[model samples]
Target: MNHFIEKTLQLKDPNITIDTEKVDEVKVNGRFSLIYYGKLSYTPKACECCGIINNAFQVVKNGYRTDSRITLNTISAMPAYLKLKKQRFSCRECG
Candidate 1:
């Protein structure tokens, strides 16, 4: 999965991580569109509310946003657009 994304997006170790629980859809015609339902690979090591840096600060999954961006490369010999529904997170202590 990682290899495919790296090759397709031409990115090395991109911070975006796919959510395997959801199925990714790809549309290919004259142009290519990859609808990846995933999340940003972010782990908060500190709490913004109390300025605490420890595991006690609970990180909660907030929601998600559909981010559509143009890719630099083409897929299947066509221009590719990435539609990523990235999951959001928040600190329980702050919110």
Candidate 2:
């Protein structure tokens, strides 16, 4: 949904760029779904001794529980399915 993508961009910092083409549509219960795939520019800081940034990694998917009753409502009332994609990195500077 355009609205969903717009909302997502609004929530992020202005410096971040979202890749809209990476978004995918999945069929859930015979209904269309929207998925987003993209990466933002991130700066990696190193410790005082070693100044090398760590390697990049792929993102992971996260899921959440939904209210069955609300989800069973009319398709119009049902909200879009959202899967949050995020990555985890370890920094020796902070560790």
Candidate 3:
């Protein structure tokens, strides 16, 4: 699992630093979910013209499952990115 996380981080951003401290595991619906918390130097929601900044967003909840019945079964890793918008701010400049 650690290796998978490492590979994911590398694929996401090779230059930015990843906060392992914020990384955590949770059990939901009897399935294991991995959570990652970190800040990207480049903001995805930043306004191109005004350069106004937007509040940080949380990534999506990701999960994976495997079946042991099949011989040499290759279960592809599941990838998901969840973004929750903040309601506190309604910035016209960045909206």
TM-score per candidate, in order?
A: 0.56, 0.35, 0.33
lDDT of 2: 0.42
* Higher-lDDT candidate of 1 and 3: 1
Clashing pairs in 1: none
Worst 10 residues of 2 by lDDT: 66-75
What is the lDDT of every predicted structure here?
0.58, 0.42, 0.39
Q: On residues 1-95, what C-alpha lDDT tens digit does candidate 1 reach at each position?
A: 75676565665546766544554445556434544444465566776676666486487667776675535465556555555656566776666
C-alpha displacement of 76 in model 2, angstroms?
9.6
Q: Regarding TM-score, does 1 or 3 come out ahead?
A: 1
Worst 10 residues of 3 by lDDT: 66-75
lDDT of 3 by residue, 5-76 (tens): 547545345433445555445553565555454333433465445666545443221232221111111123
**Candidate ranking (lDDT, best to worst):** 1, 2, 3
Q: Which candidate number has the best lDDT?
A: 1
